[model samples]
Target: MTDTPKPWRIKSARTIYNNKWVMLREYETVAPTGADASYGLVHIHNLALGVLPIDDDGHTILIGQQRFPFGRYSWELPEGGGPQELPPLEGAQRELSEEAGLKAAHWLPLIADVHLSNSITDERAFAFIAWGLSADHSFAKDSSEELTVRRVPFAEALKMAVSGEITDGFSLVMLLKADHLLRTGALPPELAKRMLAGS
Candidate 1:
């Protein structure tokens, strides 16, 4: 689709459902072809956060859990949602610690304002690469979650990502982006050397 000024003109809008985290809205609109259309949009209230925490030993952490929406097990990098009012980095750091039980001494922004499933939802994600990691036993995983954490080599994670083993779009984007940064000399030499050792 081409970007245009007012491709879809909204005639009327109404909220269908809303909760603390998300709100669903219905819109009556005129399409690009001037045809009447109805569009449903899910608005996420929180900014999605994802972190690829790499330890000094060339290992990165992943979390395994049963995704409620999909009703299946998923392996993904440490991820969660953060309040929109706070800085995204704060949320990334918090989720890295809470979900993976580890925190990093260094952080690199991989990407930001990532639109996930934009066709139906306005969910945005921010991803970071965290290195110089150490243990933090104060993990406070959400009570609603039953998570399994796995520490894997950076290379293996890359492989899993490319092989479709890591299916979460947020995690997949972060992993591939990290790999691209590392390979393209975009990362600090010291960090790249250490992480690439596992590949």
Candidate 2:
């Protein structure tokens, strides 16, 4: 049997800053081949919770907002991460309330460690599924955020993802994963009907 490859062992790790949203670390590592390397690391604060907020009738709530970096509004979920790591369910509930003013009756941990393949930073996003929401709540957005929350069926969200309208990597991963869960009976039964309703 072959041994699995292990990452170079870290000789030391130093915290550069413990910020509100991310913790920066500097690490020194000694490689198997006797090479030494240093890397600056970012530990994201929140678990990167995304809520596929669903209603009894199986509709999802989506948000379209201007991402200053992207220079346009893109469809996405209510998500954020920082030092305040609420339980996944509470995080999902809070994001739903803050972004869409909705509260899900049920929440499930879907998956974790979804990477943004194109980023220079090595990061992961954790996703969840929220079900049995009553209705949209009035959003309380950040001063910099200009968003318009939109409600759509899950089926349409899937199409948007397929067509590239949903460009955020984390959001795409979560919704698609939620779909997979549905197929395998991992998704909440009450939440399953909203999957990308064909327009």
Candidate 3:
């Protein structure tokens, strides 16, 4: 909705920091309330792509890794960043194959360009539900990545999301939404049945 009204007006902007992944800028602006204001914006260089893979047996894959920023081990969907100029689906597919060694015959768009932490950052995310999967032995990962992949029943994965065991924002949202769509007759009957088998 480009016609949507924006009350804040930017007077000036300058980059405060720049890195391979992000750029931080300080903006001189006029607030919605008609007051002088300054805001800091974090501009992400790539689009976040997330994939939740469901196998024929109602099993879903998760990847375990140590998060550099959090300095802790985390379990999450196969996710990574895609260059802004590339299609998000390609990135999602690559992440799934490389991190989980699987490829899907069918992919469903779950979420698209959802902003994360919009208050300060312009990081946008896309998610997909992938099924009809099979192993891809030639899958390759980034040299810097060290991921542990696990396959768990979809029902158990959703339980983990509810129990706070899966805390990654992208994974949490995708898992919960997939469960909702499956149970509510939103997805194809056969696919839903396969993914909800033990739920």
Candidate 4:
């Protein structure tokens, strides 16, 4: 047999639950082995956006808050959801400002598209590296969020990701990728130079 694989044949699908934020659907399908099976999928109504904001001194921002679902405090890169109608980059920028009170003059996408929790959810994420940052206090935090913002050295953030001190999957991916980019000289010369200079 050739390496090409056939797609699963979907017999039927029905939405079991739907709200403004997410939809749950169940699908009856025929597997590649011709076996009948059922699958459940969670469809997120918005795009997941995350930003790693770095300043000229190689400092990155982290936002802390108590995660309700997980029942624990989490420190992560500034992250939020973007409506499907909005561009992912715009959403990232908005989250950077709202969550951390910072804005960037330069933005580079770190992770273009990631299928977070691919097995159970159709949730996708876009992450970015933002530099040339400055304070922007006009935007207010969301009512549901009580955030504590911190600016830490880039190396420290990377360590947090590696040590599991920061458990958010999106944040871990972004920080690890940024560290790789910086170490490999993959970033633009000027930006790399700034990011290498620790505060």
TM-score of each: 0.95, 0.80, 0.94, 0.95
lDDT by residue (79-169, candidate 3, tens digit) is: 9998999999988888888889988999999999899789999999999999899888566788888889888999998999999998898
RMSD of model 3, in Å?
2.3
| Weakest ten-residue segment in model 3 by summed lDDT | 1-10
- What's the true lDDT of residue 186 in model 3? 98
Which one wins by lDDT: 1 or 2?
A: 1
Candidate 3: TM-score? 0.94
| Candidate 3 residue pairs that clash | none
lDDT digits (tens) for residues 9-39 of candidate 2 = 8999999889766688888988766689887
At residue 137, give the lDDT of candidate 1. Answer: 59
Tens digit per residue, CA lDDT, model 4, 106-145? 9998998799899899888999989999998667889999
RMSD of candidate 1 to true structure, Å: 1.8
Residue 36, candidate 4: alpha-carbon lDDT: 97
Where is model 1 more than 4 Å wrong at Cα?
Answer: 1-5, 137-139
Off by more than 4 A, model 3: 1-6, 137-139
